[model samples]
Target: MTKIAVLGAGSWGTALANTAAENGHDVRLWTHNLNQVEEINQQHTNSKYLPHATLVDTLVATNDMFLAIENVEIVLSVVPTKAVREVAKKLATALEEQAHTVILAHATKGLEQGSYKRISEMIAEEVPEAYRSALVVISGPSHAEDVIKHDLTAVSIGSSDESAAKLLQKALSNETFRAYTNHDLLGSELFAALKNIVAIASGALIGLGYGVNAQAALLTRSLVEMRDLGAAMGAKPETLYELAGIGDLIVTGMSPNSRNYRAGLGLGKGKSLQQVTEEMGMVIEGVNTTKAVYDFSKMYHVDMPITSAVYQVLYENKPLRTAVADLMARPLKSED
Candidate 1:
């Protein structure tokens, strides 16, 4: 059995740890909170994140980062975007002291602020060269809630190194969970981050009383925006149409379980951004991603009206109805 270390006690981390343990791997789950560590080890439950789910008995938890990463073959970084760099630096130090290199994989989705680097890129930048092996990105339409239920879920693993992608695919694939490998890491990461922005807009539309017809149209246009931006950044055009792209957009935009969608719904219903974030009690990745994409679009000169509209509503205090009107009032143009 392979040794696996999962950094973060969030729903996604816990679920992944459970999956690995069920597959008979030696799994170590790490969290900063000692209480969470106790809960996972003693009760096999992470009540704060996965309220209804019970983790596998063999999956262990630790509050110490060194203990978690000790002698592990794989390290799965599942922390938030804001915390990625710090965790990567720590992991690098830990791995530097180890005798062997470990495979690095991250499931966190979102672009870093200021630098605006993707999660995988940020990890590579922070991790020391000797401690790291092939870096891979694991992302798709699957949600933590569904994954814990052992719902049939499919996700894509992207890496420039084909063997790395294949290794992770073998490690994660099971009867209930499927993993597909792809070479277009850029396209997969871009689509994964940008789709959350569209989901927020989708939730806003639903809150504004727009019907399925409107939602469908908005999603189609959003796909175009995603493709345009990804292509300009050197991603393959067809990759944006794959499971990591359009498939993720559809699921995130339409599902109530999506935090970004729920946050947008709050905004559309006249609540402030602060109110939405406070009520959800979880990181609304789309909120920050909207700002990052807005800045990136300005820098890259990409045309993204819907993303800009969401940005205005979220950041500029533009009334939700006014943002909708602005979007509808755009000069007529042929569909490209």
Candidate 2:
């Protein structure tokens, strides 16, 4: 069995660790909270995140970063986007001190706020050169709640290194879960980050009592927006049509399990962003991603009307209906 270290104790992190353990790997899940570590080790549950689910018996938990990274063959970082740099820096330091090498993979999705770097890029910047060559991105439509239920799920692992991608695919795939490999790291990462923005827009439509026609229109247009932006950012156009792109968009945009969608639902119902965040008690990635993508669109000169609408509603205090009207009122253009 492989030894894997999963950094982060959030819902996604715990779910991934459980999956690895179920695959017969020796898994160590790290969290900042000692209480959570105890809970995972003793009770085999992370009550705060996955309250109703029981973790695998083989899964262990630790608060010590060094202990978690010391001898692992692979490190899967599932922390929120904002925490990526900090956790990666710590992992780099631990790896340096131990003089060990392992494959680096991340399931975290979102761009850095100020720099707009993808999560994988942030890790490559922080980690040493030895580990950078094996970096992989594990992302797709799978949600933590459904994953723990052993529901059928498929996700993509993107890496420049074919062997690294296949290794991760082998480590994670099972009867109920499947993994596919792709070489378009940039496209996969960008799609994963940008899809959250579209999900927020989709949720806003539902919360505003819009009909299915409106939801369908928003999703179709948002897919185009995502494809255009990704292409401008050096990603393959076809990647936007893959699972990491359109597939993720459908699940996050339509499913109630998406935190970003839930946040948008609150906003659509007239609640403030702060209220939605407080009520959900989780990071609404799309809220921050909307801000980032808005800035990126301006910087890249990409036309993203839906992302702009979501950003206006969230940050500019533009009324929801007004934003929708603005989107619909844009000058007529070809659908190409």
Candidate 3:
């Protein structure tokens, strides 16, 4: 069994830690929250984020960043996008000696706003460049709750290093969980990050009492937008059709449990962005990703009418009806 370290005590992190333990690895889950560490260690539960089930008895929790990093062969980072750099800096500081020996897999999905860099690129910047060679992106449609329940799930392990991706596949793959490898690291992360924006759009439709037709339209258009933006950013066009793309978009857009979807529902119900954020209490990644993608779309000269509409509604305080009208009035173009 390999030694696995999971940073972040959030639902996804806890669930992944459980998966690693169930895979018979020695699991060390790290969090900044001492109370959460204590809860995981004492009660085998992460009450705030994942209250539905208990963790494996073999799973270990620690507030010490070094303890979490020390001796682990692979580190899985499941923190939010914004925290990726800060956590990597901390990990870097803690693992000056062990950096080369470890493989780092980041599961968070979002782009850095100004740089428009994928999270993998952000990690490449924050962590030592030498360690960047070992960086891999772990992503798919697997939700934390479903994964913990042992529902069948598949993920893509993207890296320039095929061996590193294969290593993760061996470490993470199981009867209920499978891992696929790809060299499209940036493309994988791009769709994964951008889809949350579309999910918010879907939730907004539901909140606005739009029917399935509206949801379907939103999903289709968003897929196009996602592909267009990804293409502009150097991602393969076909990558948008894969699990990290259409597959992820479908699940997040439809599920009530999706934090971004719930946030969009609030907007659809006529709540302010601040109000929705306050109510969710969890990080609604779509809010930030929408802002990032808006800038990206403009910078890349990509046409994303649906994303533009949502951005206007959220940031410019344009009425939802007005945004819809604006979208409807856009010039017609080929559906290619």
Name the top lDDT candidate: 2
lDDT (10s digit) by residue, model 2, range 1-336 = 888899999999999889989999889999999999999999999988887999998899999999998788889999999999999999999998898899999998899988888988899899988755498998899999999999999999999999989988988999999999999999999989888988888888888999779888988998888888887889988778878988898899889899888888888899998898999998888888889999989999998889988888888999998999889999998899
Q: Rank the candidates by TM-score, best first.
A: 2, 1, 3
Please list the C-alpha lDDT of all candidates, in the order they appear.
0.88, 0.89, 0.85
lDDT of 3 at 230: 86
lDDT accuracy of residue 129 in candidate 1: 62
| Location of the lowest summed lDDT over 10 successive residues in candidate 2 | 128-137
Task: Judge candidate 1 at residue 60 and give its lDDT.
Answer: 96
Candidate 2 residues lying further than 4 Å off, grouped into runs, are none
Which of candidates 1 and 2 is the stronger one according to lDDT? Answer: 2
What lDDT is reached at residue 235 by model 2?
92
Cα miss at 307, model 3 (Å)? 1.1
lDDT of 3 by residue, 1-66 (tens): 888899998999998889889899998999999888888899998878877787898999999988
> Model 1 clash pairs?
none
